[model samples]
Target: MKLDEAKQKFVHSWGVLGSNWGINKTMAQIHALLLVSEEPLSTEDVMEYLKISRGNANMNLRGLMDWGIVSKEIKIGERKDFFKADKDIWEVARRITEERSKREVEPIIKILKEVKNVEDDSDKAKEFVETIENLESFTSKLDGIVKKFVKSDEHWFYKNMVKLIK
Candidate 1:
């Protein structure tokens, strides 16, 4: 296939994968477009290419920036803003992992900590406390692992992953 065809396919596939990972399809598609582009693209360019509205493009671009994967590019003497995706795939993965842990895992852990502290002596309370404790234990471990992965260099993390796979 041609380069354009391959890029379109990749963008579509990435959008689908991003939805599976709990991101909006349009946001993922915008990220995909930025990732594959050789140069930074303006919001107008993105909207035109993706056949989306200005509001939709702008909203998703801001969301991507919040996720720390996409960034705004300010050009000299340009009124409109351009955007680019971090080209380093490992860095992108690390940022996404960190963000997901913050947005999803950390909040759940906080709620578990709060709710597990109920002061009662009934059987249902005992079972509830036990369940919450187990869940807190598992989530804490998962959070620790995610933190370690976020802190470690890509080489060390991948090396350990390879060893585990082998």
Candidate 2:
């Protein structure tokens, strides 16, 4: 298949799959473009190909870099910085797992901790506290699982997580 056709399919698929992972479609699409490209691409090239504005390209590129999937590259003798996405799917997944743990899981744990510590003794407060404590337990277990997966070199974590959910 031609690069354009392949890239479009990838972008579309990634955009569709992105929502479940807490990333928006456009961001995923931009990442998909970089991921499949053989050469590093500048923001201007991305904007033109994706038909998005400069700001949109910039914002999404930064987000991809934050997720550790896309990296900025400077070509020799070229002033404009280019972006390249990670070629390994597993590395992408692992980076995403780490980032999601930090973004979604960590804050939830903090909230659960704070809520469980509330000093109210009323029945409603008691219920709230009990619920929060339970949440804290579950979230803590989740964090533990994520930590275990991140430490290991195996792919079983993702499979086990899916199993755990099922």
Candidate 3:
């Protein structure tokens, strides 16, 4: 297939993947575009390529920046602001994992810790407390694993993963 067709397919696939990961489709599409780009792209360039409105492009670009995957670039002698995605896939994965762990896992762990304390002496209350404790334990472990993965080097992680799968 042509390069343009391949890029389009990749962008669409990434958008779908982002949606599955609880991110906006357009935001992922923008990231895909920037990822494949040889140089940074301006907001107008992104809007033109994606056929999106200026506001949409700007908003998604900002969202990508907020996620710490995309960054703003200032080109010399250029009036428009340009955007670029972090080209290192490993760093991208680590950042996303760290952010999700903080946003999702940390909150669940905190809530579980708070709710696991049940003062009632009844059987149902005991069961409830036990269940909460189990959940808290599991989530805490998961959070720990995620934290380790985020901090580990790519080679070490892949080697350990290979060993586990073997």
Candidate 4:
């Protein structure tokens, strides 16, 4: 593929992956644009590059910022805010992992804990509580692993995991 085609393919693929990861496609496209950009982009620039509406650009930019992967930049003698993405791929992946864990995993653990507290004296209730407890245990283990990954360097963590598995 040509350079431009490759870039377009990357952006499109990243957007699709983001959708699968519970993020909107446009938001991922915006991030992909910023990731490939040589300089920071203003909202207008992003809208123009992505051929999106001003509102769409602004909303997705805000979403990326909230995820801590996109940040605002100030150019000297310029009033307009430019945005840039965290160019480090590892950092970007780590931030997304951390955010997803906080948003999805933590709430699930809380819900499981609450549901496991159903106090009743019947086989059905006992089975329900037992299932919930098991789920809670599994989720808690995953939560710990995610937290550890979020806090540790990717290479170091994966190396240790490999050693443990071996």
TM-score of each: 0.96, 0.86, 0.97, 0.94
Compose the digit string of candidate 3's lDDT tens values, residues 86-155: 9999999999999999899999999999997888999999999999999999999999899999999999
Write down the lDDT of every candidate, Cα atoms only.
Answer: 0.96, 0.87, 0.94, 0.91
Q: Which residue ranges in model 1 land beyond 4 Å of their true spot?
A: none
Which pairs of residues clash in candidate 2, taking residues 3 or more apart in a chain or in different chains?
none
Per-residue CA lDDT of model 1 for 1-166, tens digit only, reads 9999999999999999989989999999999999999999999999998999999998999999999999998999999999999999989988999999999999999999999988999999999999999999999999999999999998899899999999
lDDT of 4 by residue, 60-116 (tens): 999999999999999999999999999998898899899999899999999998888
Q: Compute the lDDT for candidate 1.
A: 0.96
Report the Cα lDDT for residue 45, model 2. 93
TM-score sort, best first: 3, 1, 4, 2
Clashing pairs in 3: none
RMSD of each: 1.0, 2.8, 0.9, 1.4
Say which prediction, candidate 2 or candidate 3, comes out ahead on lDDT: 3
- Model 4, residue pairs in steric clash: none
Which window of ten consecutive residues has the lowest lDDT sum in model 4?
112-121
In terms of TM-score, which candidate is stronger, 1 or 2?
1
Model 1 scores worst on lDDT over the 10 consecutive residues at 149-158
Best by TM-score: 3
